[model samples]
Target: MNIEYITTEELSKRIRYDVRTIRERLKDSVLIEGIHYIRPFGGRKILYLWEPIERDMVLHSGHHTLAIPMANGGRMNG
Candidate 1:
């Protein structure tokens, strides 16, 4: 099946932020290049993969914004 691709504009609308903000603020810091977005056919146009974005949002949606590494080779907050 041919999967549908979404533009940064679409992601902005879903996340309730300006498209420019995503590119300027969250593009490299939060959203990795190939993981969250791509340049189609080596072109400059960027398309975001919605599935990964949704999964990451779900995975990270929480109270604590810190990633405290535990001594047991894991992570926790105190």
Candidate 2:
């Protein structure tokens, strides 16, 4: 796998997310350690792996509608 390490600024540009939001919210919530990002040599700086992030974003995106089951036993596609 050709893993590319990018800084917060670079990640922000690629994902169109604000640096502050990335640092404050997405860093630990959406972007997890060892999976989405890494702290090199146990350092404080965080470097994100672009491949996994992009892949998950596309996979989780609303590309197809799924049938959701309701409490009344009816299926609704949304």
Candidate 3:
């Protein structure tokens, strides 16, 4: 499958989520590294994977939905 690479702004636009939210709240929490996102050739810039994140955004956007695993041994349900 040909994966689509998306920058922060592009992703935020499509999902209606703020870029800051994606970077601050979602990154490394709901969004996993190397799975849902990737950095450019040793660069600090992280580009989110469009397809997977999109799918996940739909799947996990809800109240009382502990869909994603948190790093602190907790779940993000609601």
Candidate 4:
């Protein structure tokens, strides 16, 4: 399996989000570690996994209703 790893700057460009937003808002909130990103060798540098993020973006897109994510990995639809 091949994974495309990208930096925060690259992710910002691909997702059309600001670098600060990705770093501050999205990271560890909407995008999770080990799922959407990883710290290689347990270092401080973060590399975002492109495929999972893209897949999730498409999956969650086109929704008119609001859904809040729960801590148990479920969503509370609103």
Candidate 5:
């Protein structure tokens, strides 16, 4: 797949999510590694992959259960 890498601000505009919310809450919680985002060149800067995220957004847009892993090895559901 031809994936497009986007910055937090760009993603915010595309997804209508606040950049702060994405950075503070959604990052690592909903948007995960090797799936939603990546750190290119092993650097601190993060680049979000749009395709997977968009796919998941559409795929999970129904009344299905959603779960996300927490940093403390627990899970949160919605």
Candidate 6:
């Protein structure tokens, strides 16, 4: 399998978001660890996986639903 890894700056350019926003706002909330990014060799540097991020962006782009997370790990779409 082939995977494309990208830096935070590169991702900011591609997604048209500020690097600061990605790092502060979206890092752990929207873009999850392991799924969206990885710390190579357990280092502090984070490399994002392009394919999954792209796929998720496309998948969620058309949705107008609001998801509210429940305490029991369920989500309610409004």
Model 3 ranges with Cα > 4 A deviation: 61-78
Please write out the lDDT profile of model 6 over residues 11-78, one tens digit for every residue.
99999999999999999999999999999999999999999999899888855467788999877887
Instruction: Give the clash total for candidate 5.
Output: 0
lDDT by residue for model 2 over 1-78, one digit each (tens)? 688999999999999999999999998898999999999999998999999899889778754458788999877887
lDDT of 3 by residue, 8-77 (tens): 8998898888999989998899889998999989799988888898677677765335467889976776
TM-score of each: 0.73, 0.78, 0.70, 0.78, 0.76, 0.78
Q: After superposition, how far is residue 65 of candidate 2 from its true place, in Å?
A: 5.9
Task: Supply candidate 4's per-residue lDDT for 1.
Answer: 94
* Predicted candidate 4 versus true structure: per-residue lDDT over 7-53, tens digit per residue: 99999999999999999999989999989999999999999999999
Worst 10 residues of 1 by lDDT: 61-70
lDDT sort, best first: 6, 4, 5, 2, 1, 3
- After superposing candidate 2, which stretches have Cα over 4 Å from the reference? 64-78
lDDT of 2: 0.91
lDDT of each: 0.85, 0.91, 0.85, 0.93, 0.91, 0.94
Prediction 6 global C-alpha lDDT: 0.94
Q: For residue 43, give model 5's deviation from the true position in Å.
A: 0.6
Give residue 59's lDDT in candidate 2 (0 to 100): 77
Worst 10 residues of 3 by lDDT: 58-67
Write model 1 residue lDDT over 1-78, tens digit each, in one string: 565579988999998989889999999999998898888899989999888888898788853466688789876855
Deviating ranges (above 4 Å) for candidate 4: 63-78
Clashes of each: 0, 0, 2, 0, 0, 0
